[model samples]
Target chain A: MGNDVSFFSNVLYMASNVQMIIAVLLGALGGVFVGFLPAFGSPTAVALLLPLTFLMPTDVSMVMLAGIYFGANFGGAIPAILVNTPGTPPAFITAIDGYPLAVKGKAKEALFVSNFSSFVGCILGAVMFYFLANVVGKAALAFGPAETFALMVLGLACVAGLSKGSIWRSIIALAFGVAITTIGIDPLTTVPRYTFGKIGLYSGIPFVPAMIGLFGISEAILLLQKGKMFEGDKVEEEKALNTKANGPTLLERAKMLPTNIISSIVGFVVGSIPGAGATVAGMMSWNLARQRSKTPEKFGKGAIEGVAASESANNAASAGALVPMLSLGIPGSSTTAVMLAALMMHDILPGPLLIVEQPGLISYLTASYIIGGLAAFIVFQLSIPLFEKLMYIAKPIIAGLVFVLAVSGTYFLRNSLTDIYIVALFGIIGYLMKHFDFPVAPTVLGLVLGGGLESNLRLALKIGGVGELFTPIASFCLLLALIMLVLPTIRSRRTRNEESQVM
Target chain B: MNRIVGLLIVIVSLAYTIGALKWSLWTEGNPGPGLFPVIIGIIALIAGVMCIVEGVIPVNGKQTLIQGLKWSAFLVALTVLVVFLMEFLGIAIGSGLAFAAVLTAGGYRRKFLLILIPIITTVSIYLVFGWWLHLPYVWIQ
Candidate 1:
């Protein structure tokens, strides 16, 4: 109870911190700006912004990142509503009802519905996060080295197996990631492993530069190849945002409060599971809302509730996905995985002890979500026209800009040309992997978790030999990993067999 | 293409596995640094072989051209040259050159965008990273 009071006081303290508040607000605005562009998701935004946070205080940087993380959810729905272009995969569901409304000249009502629902979803998710994260943290305190190893395995397996690509390709990506982790000095031993006698490789490939390269530069290359960014007609903003249109009023949109609540709950649950990210959460919640709606026929045809359902759920899931990262040091989504990597870079270890060690972080993060959501709502509300204009910038120009940023940002990491070279290498590797339909998230997660996985395995072995892996918690986690890995193959086989039977 | 990528992966993993063997697989009855790499290598090798097998199966779509490869290669080479000439050329000029080249290659024939946007972006980078974050890069002196 005393701890509760202290936590709230810290939250109040963070709310008062001018720098942190400004950081959060700036991050929110930046997130919204990035979300306006297609194919630039939260992971890319966070990765690009990471180099800037190197000099900041850990709490401030984290809050800023948290702000961006949630703010993007709000921003993502705008493009979906206006242009039928989902800025992020999760927002694809939003486009179903949103774009139809735009076509029907009710884009204003749809935008309001999306904005309000996203804000409410963020609040609900933050509330749930405040309670559930602590519970998960307490439970995770029981995890030993063996359990940790098993958990990391589960993390790797979940990413590789659950990816949209073939499991073999995903595993190949994972293996490649793990291989990258093996470069430089071995964590367990003092011996050099894959450095190839380079003097600068003593610390291994820097995570920030490599990430910047993989996500930033590779994406730029792809954008270059694509030529154009937006294909739908120019988002006739005046027509879209006409205030006097015979569209649903504020009160009518408010009627979606119940749908928002139920969908947020669904989203929160789905997001708490690793590898089932906001895209899945948004889809699940939107479908459930459709099933339960009184006016089911209105779905996918400009139902304001549909927009509310997807936007709310995906936003909530963004918050929910932080539970595992904060509590167990295992990221619940790819964005949080990048966040986790950034946290580790600052030497701020996350896990069961993190909450106890820095109880203020949760409060600050919670406050960030509230403020960031409100800020995003306000920004989107007033500046819809501004974002519309931003969408007009050519993709090639954006690609060029990203290219320069990627080069310079990477150079700023260690102020070394070698880091730049490493980034270029990884950029090519990332591009190739993308070309081959291999998932990249697993590789990032694998690299981030690789050292921990190795160190934990060594520690667990020293403590209890090979038999330690069969301990209840360890075995349970391993079983979960195995199940995740095998389920996809089985499901695909079944799908193939059913298709053949149909033929 | 898939077969070549798979074969490359196989060779790399095989070499990696061999390289890992140079280190002690175990020390004091515990798994050593090499053991994990060996395991990872084997997994990669298996996945590579699987990839090779999967490649044999026919697919529907025609293989697409590696469009924009020339531009992509030019961008990479320009970036390398920029880095190499950082002391002489500085960030702003190098970035502008790279940006203009890419924009031109991407079919932006508009002289205004090709010229103006690069300057704007270069300045923005300077203001954001150089001024705000104080990134100690060699800029136009």
Candidate 2:
């Protein structure tokens, strides 16, 4: 109890700092702006801003970035609910129910619920960060090279699980990613592996350029092929689409409280695990809610419960991602991975000694999230009508705008044309992969985890001796990967046999 | 398309593994540079082989590999074009062109879309990176 009070007071003191306050407001504003824009998102935003952090105080810069990180999640829900276009990846699930609600003239209700759920999730996550910081930090300290390697393998294996298509294809993508990671200098020997005599390849594949190519450029191509799938102008024609005019009544809002609470818990738990983020949480929650609901058929048709479940889970996942990042230095999602990078840039090592080293920093970071969430909720609610109006704009204009932003953002990273080329190259790769039902996310996951896995594996082998490669931790991770790889094959065969029988 | 992709990956992996084996798989005092790459190459080779086999042998009425290739060409073209442009024009200009081209190709017919999207996107990015944030612009020069 005494510790809690001390932590609370420390947070208050940190928040009172004029510099920290300014940082929070700036980050929150940046987050909202990026979140509202379809092309701009947290990772790109961070990459664009990475250079600037070199000039500012590490703590202030990190706090500001963290604020933007959470703020984006909060702001992302607006476009998703009103326009059916997810401004960020986490909001993809939100569009499932949110767009339907908007189509049904329940846009205001969707907006309200989204904001409310976001606020609830942020607060819950902040509380967890504050109370459990010490415990998590200590646990993180115990993780060594072997455990880290295992964790990476587990993360890569998840690609098979999360992929919508054949697991075999996903594994192929994952392996491709791992292979790409080996293109630069060898971690142990410092000798070049697949650089092909190129100086640029010495550093391995640059993350920002590769990511821009993978997510940003690829998406543009896909969207272009589909030809303005989001025609917001059609919304104006539907007089029944004005959700604000016929908002949910107070009693109805009250009834959703229980659903929101349950979904938030589900989001938080799933989010705290490394690799799983809002997408998984949202899908899981929505599925559970549908299973529990009396009318499961209403799920795809704009059910209020669906909106609540998805929104709550996604928002909670945003908060939950912080858990592993703060405790173990392992990012729970891509966005958090960027955040971890930001922290590293600031020289703030996020591990066991983090709290002891900077007592008030954890408290302040937690408080900043709370404040950011509240601010985002208020700002998002107030701008609902305006955003709804923006959705009526033509699709061509939106696509054009998004493409430009994505390109420019990629250019900003390291100011190199090489990066731009990488983006373009990946964009094509991303597009082709999609056309052939080759999943892009696994590639991204592979890119993100590939370097880490290889480096750690080498380091662990060096430290533990060649014989130690078969240690419990390494063996365990390998076993898990084998299971992940084999299980899908078994499942697919069984399903095929069953279908043949039915035929 | 699947078969080509698989074949390309397999060939690349096999070539890289052979190169790595020649360079150094293991040394007496320290681990060789080729060790990790060799492992990754082997994995890639195996996966590529599996993918190719799957492409060759259909499981449940999936599209033929050649059918997949036709659809993938446009994307590959777009990628190659962007990469070439990025080197000559720089990131901002190259990206703006790519964006405009892709969006236009995507069926965005409005004249305003082409003009406004590029201008707004370029200017806003300039402000964020060049003016407000003052990040060093490497691609432009």
Candidate 3:
């Protein structure tokens, strides 16, 4: 009670500052705009905008950047929902169900649900961060290399659930992705293992460009492959769009509030863990919602609950990622890592002492989530119709836009043409993978976690050999991974046996 | 086709695992760069063999690989060509050409749209990413 009162008091105090308010609004608006652009994720936007903040005061800049961080979560969902192209990797989960809704002419409902859930997620995650930041930060700091490695393994093992095809294919895809990550100079010994004498290979295949190719370019190719078949579906969708709005009512949307809150909590916890990003949070929450739902078959087939679960979790995870960064000087994701650098650039050190020394800054940052969420929501709501029109655009134009943006976004990453080649290569690979029914999500998750997994494994071995895996948290993660991998197979076998017996 | 893909995966994983052996598996009594890759390679190798076996097993119905390959190959060729052209024509012009080519390939028959939208898109992209944001590195020079 005392803490709540103090937190509310501080929030009220910061809310009164007009400059702070303006900064949050402006940053959030910019964030939404960039995020709405295909292929421009939050990390790129924040990295690009960081230079502009050098002229501003530390508190103002921090709040503004934080606002952008919060808002990008909302903006990334637009492309994912309207089209099947995810602006960020995590938004891919939103596209699973959200795009189907758009195809069903329920784009308005999809966007509304996404935006509303994001708003709820932000507020709830902020409240949780305020209450548990210190505790969560301390727990996160306790993670050693073994625990981190084990957690990553657990994350990778979720491929069992993520895969909708042959398990062997998913495993191969994941291993292939991990192999690709090993191309760079080894973190442990600085030895280039698979560079093949190319300068770009020394740094390994960049993940973002690879993502752009996998999702964006590959989608374009798939759409083009359909030709007349795709046009037929598009015509039906266009007709559906013109006919009537067939979606869940406002009350039905309201019924998902509990789901939003639950997913937000899940996202917040996952996000607080160092290096466990919004993608993992979104994946985990979507899987959990499927497990808990009465109509599990509706998942990935236009379930509104799927969109609600994923959007809320990803947004809340963005907010929750701040807990470790603000409290313990550890960043949980790439965007927060950049924000940490921004703080250090301003000579504002973040750690245990940060809360005591910079109460106003911390309070203002937490309060900005609500403001930023509201700003992003209003902007998105106002533009829902415009965003939905993207669905009606000619297929050729959409394909061209995806190609240009994918290529351009990859180029902007490091101003390297090598990345463009990487995108092209992955574009072909992704197309083949999709055609073969191999799940791409596992490959993505593996790529994202591969470097960390290796570094942590080597570090843990040095620290304690195999004994490191015996630690409580590490063992718990291994157990969880085992359960995640085994349970589905067992269930499927049981169902098959029962069917055979009935027949 | 599944058998071929599986065989390719097997060959690649074998090569990768062998390549990993060139690097030390352990250094200074700790695991080295080769360890992780070797583990991954082994997993992939096993999975590939299983995929191959599965592919060889006869199922209830005939499995057919669709004819989606030609269009995808065309798109891929265009992508490579556009990137190559960007070196000489600049990103704006290269992208304009790409837009026109892709639109035509995707069966857009309207002549005005094929001509006009590409120019508009090129100029708009340049203005936003090149002039205003100072992003998208190379423009003309």
Candidate 4:
């Protein structure tokens, strides 16, 4: 009780103080601005701001980063609502109902519902992480390489299953992603695998460059192909929605509480899985809410429930993603992976030890969620009009700017020309993948997990004989992975049979 | 389209398999470096074959063209231009020029805006990535 009181008091102090509050608000603002741009998700926002954090106190610095992470989800919903395009992967689900609502001149209402639901989700996720940290954190320590390998398999399978009819394409993309990481010198032995005798290939593929290329440059190329950014003649209709008074009343907003709560719960669970990330969590939440909705026909047709379901789930997922990283030293999502890297840079080893050693630090970081969520809501509400105007920035201008940023942002990471070429190659690949109806998420996630998966598999086999793979934990995870892979196919067959009967 | 993509993947993975076989596969009880690559190669091959099979499967639903893009050729050209320019003149100038070029390609003809937008963009990038972030390169100057 004493620790709880101190924790709450410190959080209050940090949030109430002028400077820390300003830092959080400013970080949230930057997050929103970055999140509004295509391919500039929370990872980029955090990566860009990581250097600045070194200058501040640990608590303030973490609070600022927390603000940015939470703020990004809110910011992503704006462009997704206003434009049919998603700024971040999680926002992809938001765009389904969001764009339609914007088409119906309910942009402000969607924005309001999203922000409000995000707050609720943020609160629930924070509470879960704080209370469950002691129990789940311990279980996480028992996971070995075999377990991790199985988990990665499950992650990839889930991605393929959720590809929305592009399962094979997603699988191919995932395979290519994993294969690409095999280049450069092999970690186990010094032998180079796929270098083709090039000196530049010795250091392995840079992660950030590939990411910026796959997401940023591909986005630019896609925008160029689309010919225009936003639909014209809808400008006047959009203007009507921009009116401050056009938002939903408090009572009407309260009605969506049920959907928001359900989606948030779903988001929290999905996010707890390593590598599952916000995209799946949010997607699952949105789908579940839609299924449970009384007026199913209203979904994907300017439904407020869609915005609530998506926003709540993704926001909650962010906090859930952190639980594993903070406690067990495993990254639940790529964004948290980046955060793990950042924490390591600060000489803080993130595992069970840190939780016991630095209880105050952990509390401060957790408290940032509550404070950051409120800050994000305030910042997003104030900046909605500015973001809408950003939507109108000339299509070519945005395309050009995105291309420039993608290239330069990638190059700056290592100052290597090889990085530039990788970005270019993957940028083209990404564009083609987009053109070919191949989901890009699988490819990126595969790349993120490639090194870790390979090394883990080898390490597990090295430590224990081949039989180690059959440990109860590893076997259970592998069984779950197998189910993930086959269950989708079975479901699709069942759906086909049911349709045939109906016909 | 499916067959073409599938064939491309198969060919690529086949080439990779040949390269990987140069390394020893199994060393003692633990697997060697080549083992992982072999597994990756097999996965690629399987996915490629699956792609081919899926292509042949008839569908009653809408089929969107995956690789059919009228602007693809132009987009490729723009990508090449940015990459090449980035090598010679540095990111700021290269990106400025590429920005103008892409704008023109996208059918934007506002002469002053094109010129002004690039300058502003380059300056902003230099300020953020160069001056503030201390990245190694942004402007040649």
Top-scoring candidate (TM-score): 3
| TM-score of candidate 3 versus the correct structure, residues matched by position | 0.91
Ranked candidates, highest TM-score first: 3, 4, 2, 1
Top DockQ prediction, candidate number: 3
Question: Ten residues in a row with the worst lDDT in model 1 chain A?
Answer: A229-238
DockQ of each: 0.49, 0.33, 0.52, 0.45
Per-residue lDDT of candidate 3, residues A185-233 (tens digit): 9987999988988876888888888888778877787777665455676
lDDT of 1 at A225: 61
Q: lDDT by residue for model 4 over A261-359, one digit each (tens)?
A: 888887886677666567767766765676577875576577789889888998888888887898888888767887899878767788877777777
DockQ, candidate 1, vs. native dimer: 0.49
Top lDDT hit: 3
Over A170-204, each residue of candidate 1 has an lDDT whose tens digit, in order, gives 78878887788888898767899888898788788
* Candidate 2 per-residue C-alpha lDDT over B1-141 given as tens digits, one digit per residue, 9 for 90 to 100: 456667887898798788878677557744566777788778778877887876732232133323333323554564456556655654455556656765566666678766767666566555665567766541465
Residue A281: error of model 2 in Å?
9.6
Candidates ranked by DockQ: 3, 1, 4, 2
After superposition, the stretches of candidate 3 with alpha carbons farther than 4 Å from their true spots are A1-23, A50-60, A228-234, A237-243, A344-347, A498-503, B55-68, B135-138
Error of 1 at A376 (Å): 3.6
A269: Cα error in model 2, Å: 8.5
A-chain TM-score, model 2:
0.71
TM-score of chain B of each: 0.81, 0.58, 0.78, 0.68
- Candidate 2 docking class: acceptable
